[model samples]
Target: MRSLFTIGLIASWYASNIGVLLLNKFLLSNYGFKYPIFLTLCHMMACSLLSYIAIEWLKIAPMQRVKSRLQMMKISALGFIFCLSVVGGNISLRYLPVSFNQAVGATTPFFTAVFAVVMTSKREGWITYVTLVPVVAGVIIASGGEPLFHLFGFMMCIGATAARALKSVLQGLLLSSEGEKLNSMNLLMYMAPVAVMALFPAALYMERGVVGITIALARDDWKFLIYLLFNSALAYFVNLANFLVTKHTSPLTLQVLGNAKGAVAVVISILIFKNPVSITGMLGYSLTVAGVILYTEAKKRSM
Candidate 1:
């Protein structure tokens, strides 16, 4: 029964994660909603509201309070990084096929390892370091063979991936102390509103007239509102499911699941979007995923 529950949580995480990606791609790429910043803002807003309800009112997770001004500053910094990652991801989806985007995103472990070394001066074993070679090489191969490749989209996706890894490193650095540590749910509870605040001015500056455009679009199609709402809700669920999965299982299991999730997402995306994938592209993606799995195993053994 416990194993069944874990399976359900994993399934939910996959669904929420992939669902949000597809919905974001559809809204930005096909549905004519081109404002990635605004879309990300809506997601943060939903996360902020839902996290509060889940932690405070519903008692789904214990409430955690920001203990100090310095802690608040750290969380704000994380929120800024989170905004960059999410908005960049959404923008990329407009220009890149979902499969290609996921392909680029699969290099995140490589970035994370690099950041850990550069930022913290932590060194991994030679075997672990060597594993990253194929991770980088595979992306290079995929880029050359991607039929729908957009240079701008590739850059944005890479930037988002690096920012994501940086966030993980920074979180460990900034919140490693027992007093400062907050579980994922509580962290989201605080971080989401900060992200919304950080995103608002940028959205206004970068996506001028988006508000009016979204409103007009919604007026023409009431279902647009539904799409936004559902997408935003899934955004929150993605984080929730991730935290739950990690809590119920081990972090190693989560890492393994995440690697598989990227592959599954790529296949589902290709099927749904009807994106053309060259044989080289698929081989490159396979190599990258294989490298990630090897990296995970190497890290596990080192630990």
Candidate 2:
């Protein structure tokens, strides 16, 4: 029964992750919402509200407090980074196909390793480092083959990937102590509101009339509100499912599932969006995923 519950959690993680991605793509690309920053802000808003309800009202996870000013500052820094990653990702989806986006995203492990070594002077084994070569090369090959390649989108996606990796590395360095280290759920509870605070001003500056536009759009079509609401809900579920899966299983398991989830998302996205994909693009994505798997194995062995 416990195993079954874990399976359900894993499934929920995949579903929520994929669902959020597809919905973001639909709203931005097909539905013509085009306001990536505002959309990301909405996601953070949902996360903030849902996390509060879950932790405070429902008592889903034991509430954890920020231990000190320094810890709160660290969490705030993480929130800023989270805003960068999520906003960049949403913007990239506006220009890039979901299939291609996942291909580029698969290079995250490469960035993570680089950031880890640079930020912490932590060195993985030579074999582990070698695994990153295919990861980088695959993205390059995919870029050359992608018919719908957009330079700005590619760059934004790369930025998002690097920001994500940096956040992971910094989390280890900044909150390594027992007193400072909060569990994922509580961490999200704190980070979500901080992210919202960071994103609000930027969204106002970058997307000046997005609020008015969103309201006008919703007035014209009530379904827009429904889609926005559902999309934001899915975003929160993605984070919740992620925390639950990590709690129930090892981080290694979560990493492996994440890799598989990307591939599954790619296939499902191609089907749903009917995005044209080349053989070279598929091959590159496969290679990247293969490299990530090898990297995971090598890291496991080293540990």
Candidate 3:
């Protein structure tokens, strides 16, 4: 039964993740929504509200009070990183093909490895280190042959990827070090609101006097607003599933599953967007996906 629940949670996480990716691409690229930061702010707002209801009203997860000022600060710091990572990803979608974006985003494990080594002085087995090579190499190869590659988009995606990795590492360290820790639902109840607060200023500044334009566009097309609301709701589920998965399974499993999700997302993006992929790009992406699988297996063996 536990295994079944884990599988269900993983499935939900992957589905919601892919759904949001495609939906966001549709909005930002196809539908011509020009404000990534604002969209992210909307997502955070939705998540904040949903998390509150889940924790406070629905009683999904017991609320745990923060034991100290230090812990609250740590979670707030995480919220800041979360805002940046998400906004960066949404912005990159505006300028890059989802195929290339997922390919680049798959490099999160590589960044995770680097951060683990640098921050925690954690050493991995040789095979663990070896598996990351193809991950990085593949992205470099794909970048060289990408038809839709924009330098700015590539940078933003990479930044988002690294920030995500950093968050994973930091969250582990922060939560573990504390005597009392909030579970994922409770943590998000706090983090989501902070993330919304952190992102609003940036969205306002970045969107820059375009509120009238966005409001006009939304009024003209109620469907777009519907899509945005659905997208944000899916984002909330993604967060819930992410925490549940990590709680039920090991982080290593989540890491491996994430790579698989990215691969699936790339294929779906290609089919939906009819994006052209070069021979070199396909080979690179294939290699990267295979490498991530191998890395997952290697980690399993080491464990």
Candidate 4:
């Protein structure tokens, strides 16, 4: 029963992630939503509002109050990083195919390992470190052959991936030692609002005139509004599902699920977008994914 529950969580995470990514791509790439930052702000807003209702009204989890100035600062810092990571990801989608983006994102485990070692002085065996080689090499190979590679988009994707990895490492380090370490749902409740605050000015400045355009577009097509709402709604589910998955299973299982998710997302994007991928790109992504699986297995064995 526990295994079945874990499988369900994994399936939910996969479905939510894939659905959200495809929707965002369709909105940004096909539907001509040019302001990725603004779109990201919308996502954050939805997350914040839902998180508040979930914690405060629905009582899904006890509301965790901000206990200390220091803790607030810490979470705020995390929120800022989260904004960068998510905004960067959305921006990348504007210039890159979803397939290539997911391919590049496959390198996140490498960044996670590096940050874990640097942040916590944790040591991994040489075999563990060596596994990262193929993960990185595969991405580079795929990048070189990416049919629609944009330099700016590639850089943003890499930055987003690294920031994501750093968030995981820092959250573990900082939150573990806190007197009151909030669970994932409460953590999202606090982080989502701060992330919105961090993103607002940037969205306002960078997306000047975009608001009116989007509003006009939405007015013409009510479906645009629906897509935006659905996109943001899925974002919330992604966070909720991730938290539930972690609660039900070990982090190792989540990591392994992530490896599969990346590959599946890439394939789905290729099919949906009809993006042309080179043979070299396919081989490269395969190596990266295989490396990620090896890394996960190695870590699990070590544990």
Candidate 5:
């Protein structure tokens, strides 16, 4: 049962991430700038509600221990930071293509590996550094090499990478003390609510009144309400899955999987939205996959 739970948790996390990315791509095409804002809110809220039910009704606690107040506060703070990075990364998407955003997100593995070394004091072998070369090269190729240089969107991708890496590191930190209790469901309980709350100031500052939301939604400018509601639900579980994947697998494998997300998301975005991708972008995507494989191999050997 324990092993099955771990496998299920990992499968769900990857699938959930793919679903969230696809949803964001769909919502973005129909709705304009505000798509991410409300979507982010809905995502967190739905996830929180679901998580609460699972905890209370289904008894989905990951482990035995209940968290301390101080610990809860710490988790909340990390949630806030994670949500903020997500918002920033999503906002960047509005300016750039989804593939581009994802390519940038590939950088998360690089950031995670570095941070792991620094924070956890876990040192990778010298070969690990060499492995990153192809990953970086693949990302560059996947980003449409020259076009990325012309567009500022590349920077946004970088931001997404940083945000994701930081979130992963933060999650690991939260798990440090409460080792047994740090399962995916357990982490989601506190973090989801805090992340949802993190969106308020942005929503307030960029306030679109009830009428605007209605019109935007009704006009089919985007399934505004549906996007909001579903996203909130999806994001919570998506995050929960993340913890499970990281805990069950090697962090490097998680990074590789995370990097592949961009490759998969780009293809999905293009197929679903008819988003254009250059030859270089295709090459980059291929290279990224290669890079991930190479890195994974290096990691395996080091082990």
Candidate 6:
């Protein structure tokens, strides 16, 4: 049934995304890789290969037409933004606790909504706007009402969040365009390679020389490599699910579900790292999770 497919897709999407966060925590902590940009490059490379092969071999998209220069260029630019979303988040982990990182991420759905309106020139209802307030408030509470984790570092988190928001909006724009046909595989094929390339110079500069890059890769711990692979797979998994779910459900539902990742992420983070959970944190986490579920339920009823 259509409904069953939608349910399964959402479930798979959430699992993969939350899995990525858990693996990312491992990546940030264990990898000898020093540069955010460099680590991101490595991650993007892994995704690129997987996507390219899948798109070409599986022929995921219908043979509608090849994308035009203008559309391809737009996708490339969004690719760069996507790179920032990862690198910036990687950088943020250096300054903030993993739980804190996940907490701030709770605001993603609200920002997704705002970006949607701006990108599509569409109007959202009052209830939709009202729902965002609680999501955000929960995030603040979860963060212990902390101000920026570190001045520059916290700013980087904000940048990452903004990039994430933009990615969501841009995805809507790109996917909805009349002449553009992209399966999830096609989009990732275009993005991950280009994004990896875009990060090379930044990564190179940060490392200062080939020696730095060599040293980072030379350690080559098996455990760490496994984690990196996990990171790559998780990144692609949720993404493919995102596309498939979009086909079956509404974007608004996807956005709402996306917010719950923060809660799932926070719990796992606390389990892995023994993160301190304050009363405020408990309250915030509960509220954020409840709000996202409520919003999704309300949306389903309306439909």
The candidate that achieves the highest lDDT relative to the unseen native structure: 1
As for lDDT, the candidate ahead, 2 or 3, is 2
lDDT of 6 by residue, 1-303 (tens): 878878888889888887876666665664435466766787798788766665667765443344578887878888899999999998887666677777666666667777878778775666766777777777667666543345566677878988998986887776676667566567777888789888888877776774455455657656555766677777777777887787788677676666665666777778886755677767876776666666565555556
Which 10 residues in a row give candidate 3 its minimum summed lDDT? Answer: 176-185
Best-to-worst TM-score order = 1, 2, 4, 3, 6, 5
- Model-by-model lDDT, in order? 0.93, 0.93, 0.88, 0.88, 0.69, 0.72
For residue 134, model 5's alpha carbon misses the true position, in angstroms, by: 1.7
lDDT of 4 by residue, 225-256 (tens): 99999999899989988988888887777887
Q: Which 10-residue window in model 2 sums to the lowest lDDT?
A: 178-187
Q: What is the lDDT of residue 42 in candidate 5?
A: 62
CA lDDT, candidate 4, residue 294: 88
> Each model's TM-score?
0.98, 0.98, 0.93, 0.95, 0.80, 0.81
Whole-model lDDT, model 3 = 0.88
| Model 2 quality (TM-score) | 0.98
**Candidate 3, superposed: residue stretches over 4 Å from native:** 1-9, 246-250
- What C-alpha lDDT does candidate 6 achieve relative to the native structure? 0.72
Measured with C-alpha atoms, the lDDT of residue 84 in candidate 6 is: 93
Please give the lDDT score at residue 269 for candidate 1. 92
Better model by TM-score, 1 or 4?
1
Candidate 3, TM-score vs. the true structure?
Answer: 0.93
* lDDT string, candidate 3, 122-152, tens digits: 9899999999999999999999889888999
Displacement of residue 68 (Cα, Å) in model 1 is 0.7
Error of 5 at 242 (Å): 5.1
- lDDT tens per residue, model 1, 90-174: 9999999999999899999999999999999999999999999999999999999999999999999999999999999999999
lDDT pick, better of 1 and 2: 1
Candidate 2 C-alpha lDDT tens digits along 1-303: 999999999998999999999999999999999899889999999999999899999887899998789899999999899889999999999999999999888899999998888878999889999999999989999998898999999999999999999898889999999889888788888999999888888889988899999999999999999999999999999988998898899899999999999999999999999999999988888999999999999999998
